[model samples]
Target: MTYDRCLATLKAISGREAASGYSQRALKQVFGTSKVTFPLSYDRQEFFSKSVEYSKGISISGVQEKLSLRLDRASNELVVTRNNGEYILKPSPEAFPNAAENEHAAMLASQKIGIETALCTLVPFKTGELAYLTRRFDRLESGDKRPQEDLLQIGGLPPKAKYDVSYEKAGELVDQATGGKRAVKLDLFRRVLFAYAIGNNDLHTKNLSLQRAVESSSRFYDKLTPNYDVLFVQAFDNTKEGQFMACDLLTDPETGEEEFTEPYQEYGFYTGYDFLELGRRYGLPERAVIRAIRNQVDSQGDMIELIQSSYMPEEMKREAEVIVVGRCRAISTGIDR
Candidate 1:
């Protein structure tokens, strides 16, 4: 089925059937794609371990292929409606350390240096906050039923939902998501690099998506989703203890607007690990990884100085630098990968 049909179906299901053709069309573009095939690769074990090793600085959702919705956000993808039309809420969060702003900064920087990103809108939330939300590329695969969860169900074993999908399966998943007719983008290479340099470790299947479709019944094709959730570890003070690393995530549940800085956790992290692993998943060269590490070290001062001036105090900024820079040096040269 064509993506237009899929859009029609999803909109109907969401009770947005009467939401105006133009609005629905806008939504359709978010999930549309050219149909084509391009070879891809993966390595889950490497990604998982590296994700943790790389995340040694903060709690992360572990890499996901897509940000599929559950029963909770069952109705709408971006905004939530309730009260039987009495009230509606959007997915915007009113919190510290803007995730969208960092994403925009990072994307602009990455693209300036020639990186590929589907690109996204800098949407403002009701809370006066902004967060980058990428569109889902995978279609409603519950037999093309257009269920919201279908987005999450991709990348797993066949005839099964929620099957284990790994990094190695990334290529295959990309094929299906992109309709086997999309170009193999080199910008993704830069995305992996820039994400590391900026510490946007939230790279997962959901965060990364494809836009595939067959317009006018011509053919199928796809491309990776735009960069979203590009928040940086340095965006906040990060001074809270036990907030960094994969171990901390695997161990407990956390709540609070704490600093992503140090005392770090028992794992010893100053910032976040996404910086290191973003390169690892793509099989980045050791030279590249080392270069990224060194670059961050060199640039940390400027970054910290900037942060101190804006969102944090001098002591908080200094602590972040010590934890992040000192430990990064230790790990960068010694990492086995």
Candidate 2:
């Protein structure tokens, strides 16, 4: 019931020997706790049943099963309920083995590359299963809920149409949200490029959101929320198309031909040109986008080390490394042209 070594930093997760663990102050600020273990029974069946029942009202949209939890500081435990919860916990899916580990590694990789990603960690269930834990960013220190909208809603699209828009539309949403701030636009471009480089083909509208400041007077003012739900889908899903991307970098012109055309066929596999064009559409310089891509490419070693330290199986670790390295090379080669 005690961890002598942290899975992340190789220190203690708790106990009197927890000095070198994830910084207590930083953990408290980000996750509301320095304690790594969730002080609750890890009954997978009970948890899933409760989450299914709760989804009727407090549904977190996605194919995966997730539960919102509030940390009872007095007892230092997590309860399966939506009562002002500070974290979202996702168990490994039955269909996708090692999903929690995959997501945890992906989030860590994103963070290492300087992306403002949602804080995440892997926790062990009593059943010896690992779950992905992410701190909720939509809540304030005073326990006030901040107003937030996803790209789908911001673009005036219904939830059912989440996958219908191109990635450029998200840039438009960011532009409107930040009132044409060049820095935010450039950052958005970097995020998009990062998604491509990491083989995350699931950057759908729901995955990107805008959060309004708790004290902002204007209703329209907001900023991009920390990146969430990023994963190397192609690495895990064998059935996934090799050239697939979640959203188009640009809208393809209508040829008006009745022949069958593969999605994003003209651009093929989201090359550097696609990302550069996306940046140009948002008024970001091509050199800036190239720099962003190169910066991430340079961090491949750090990314691999973090991946190795993750809880994913060794086979999966090898697969993920290959996917990441291959993508980085492809992006770098494309950009050099």
Candidate 3:
């Protein structure tokens, strides 16, 4: 909430110590300019007033309030725009505490574990509150919008049904849509494992998506889009009642029963074997499955390190670390353990 020497570093925008502000590398990546900070042309009061009118007819999905904006390199400022915006800004949701910092930290952690994530960072509003900002991966350098579709629409489901589908079914739909691309399936498997490891229980159908391949001639989108909308939901209060995963990972499709390994039944959490079973069900090779699970397990320290150095409040950072460690432990051990 307060500015420090390591603000940009803590936000995961800069890897090195940025004593003055954002490092050159980070500034180049996010702003495509030499700006020290992403100063907005509008203040918080103006943003709050204008965003309401700007949000109408905005096609972007999700429950968070979003404003589309474009970077003016000539002026070195980000300005609100109703059309052809290159970035999506998410101010902290009133209902969700520290949502902006939570998302920025989680997204960087996801990238650390090898998940392809949308380029994002935490930008300070003129009022000093931090907001989550992500570049629109669906847009090109020429300001052209790429063909992109979330899994919900691809599966012919409405927004209300986003939470109704299972990962197994979603993966199946993705396989069909992508023409059974093995690499895409493998990436999907890794993403699912990463989501669970981070205690991101909000990775429903609408969160996963595909974009049209830049080189392809086909009309269908055959490429998986970068991961987005990821954050640690367990850091919030009163969020522990639901299942571990957003979808029915433990459900037996044929029997319509939730299946749990012996350790799961005893300990009441998924073990490494459960993840292995899921990879197998998703038709990923055994070696790849083992590797993906190992990737998540091995990145435990990195995830915690990011959380500790994040812009989240101290209490929330500690809570997030505990949640991530618990999930990582759950996913690292076998059923026998």
Candidate 4:
């Protein structure tokens, strides 16, 4: 949707309803600022477009229609990521509407919530004539400034397994993929929260990544990066609740389960996260969890704006709210029944 239409819709919604109790950060996401417009000189569908021959691993087939793979530049993302071999090309007038915009919002939301995620910034792509592209977390071993552009989701444990089916399995996979050096505490929780907050139900085992950063500028740091690939696919399909929740096998922490076992089973999702126990393990506070929830609620407008600008129509927008806010709220204060 155009900025004018987005604003008008929000105005209409705001006038019709009142703040339904959201977090401050969530509110900012609903209408904080303009999406950073990326410059692009390359059009993927152009008559003279060039298709580079990189390994096609585990990306959603046919998604490149709206995105092109290319190297982009920006100072902000420089320090955050180390050696991404390739950067995903995101062109303007993109094949799909508002995907790039929604992604940008997801990353910004991750940062706002104190998650240890990759540094992200919108930059021009396609020779700075077409549109903007979001970079990846993988580093290039080939030694060219433009990383090889291997899709991060393709790098999960055991090479090409899904994470959504079982998180404990994912934990073990993380150890295997990274050769036993998993940043369990920081990496896992952030990913869990990010998936919930951004509505990224597609976070299958393949979607989450484990980077082996170069120790001597050659040996990669064998651990997970903050988080990436943050867009809600459930929005595209009518499945807006972001399915794939289950009673995953709860692992045996004391026994030190094998690193590759699919420990958790899929139990149904609880409306909100009760971090009281989880927070204690990480030395994090339950208040922090509450604060995060509040931020998501408060900045819901910005989140709404991002969605409104994307392929999501106004009707779907209301549906998204029913699921997103409703589910989030259900978990937050339901200390008892």
Best by lDDT: 3
> lDDT tens digits, residues 1-337, model 2?
4445453433235664344334465456555667644434767787788887765322222557888887766766777775787788887777777888788788877887888888876666666577777888888867787789888888888878776777776787888876777887776777777777777888888888887777788756466788888876766756346555676666543742222123225644555655666777788877888888789788888878877777678888887788778777766756774
> What lDDT, from 0 to 1, does candidate 4 have?
0.43
**Candidate 3 stretches greater than 4 Å from native:** 1-20, 36-38, 56-63, 255-263, 335-337
Tell me the tens digit of each residue's lDDT in model 3 across 1-337: 3344344345433333343346566667866765644445566667768878898522122446778888766776788888889889887766686888888898888888888888887777766677888888988777787778899999999889887777777778888888888788888888888888877888888889999877778866677899998988778664655567887765676786566657677887777887888777778888888878877888889999999888889988988899888888888787332
Question: Which of candidates 3 and 4 reaches a greater TM-score?
Answer: 3
For residues 1-337, write the lDDT of model 4, one tens digit per residue. Answer: 1122222122223321222222223323432323222233334454124333333322332354223243323321211112343345443233345454445545555655556555444433434232223444453446433212122343423443343235554555554454544344345645665566556666655455555544334333355665666655454444454353321323447764422222111223443333333334444455665555555556666665655553345665565455566545544543332
| Deviating ranges (above 4 Å) for candidate 2 | 1-5, 8-30, 35-39, 56-61, 253-268
Q: Which window of 10 residues has the lowest lDDT sum in candidate 1? A: 33-42
Backbone clash tally for model 2? Answer: 1
TM-scores, all candidates, are 0.38, 0.85, 0.90, 0.56
- Sorted on TM-score, best first, the list reads 3, 2, 4, 1
Regarding TM-score, does 1 or 3 come out ahead? 3
- Scored by TM-score, the top model is 3
Candidate 1: tens digits of C-alpha lDDT, residues 303-325: 44443332223554455445545
Evaluation by TM-score, superior candidate among 2 and 4: 2
Q: Over all chains combined, what TM-score does candidate 2 have?
A: 0.85
* Superposition error at 154 for model 3 (Å): 1.2
lDDT scores for all predictions? 0.37, 0.71, 0.77, 0.43
Error of 1 at 31 (Å): 19
Between prediction 3 and prediction 4, the one with superior lDDT is 3
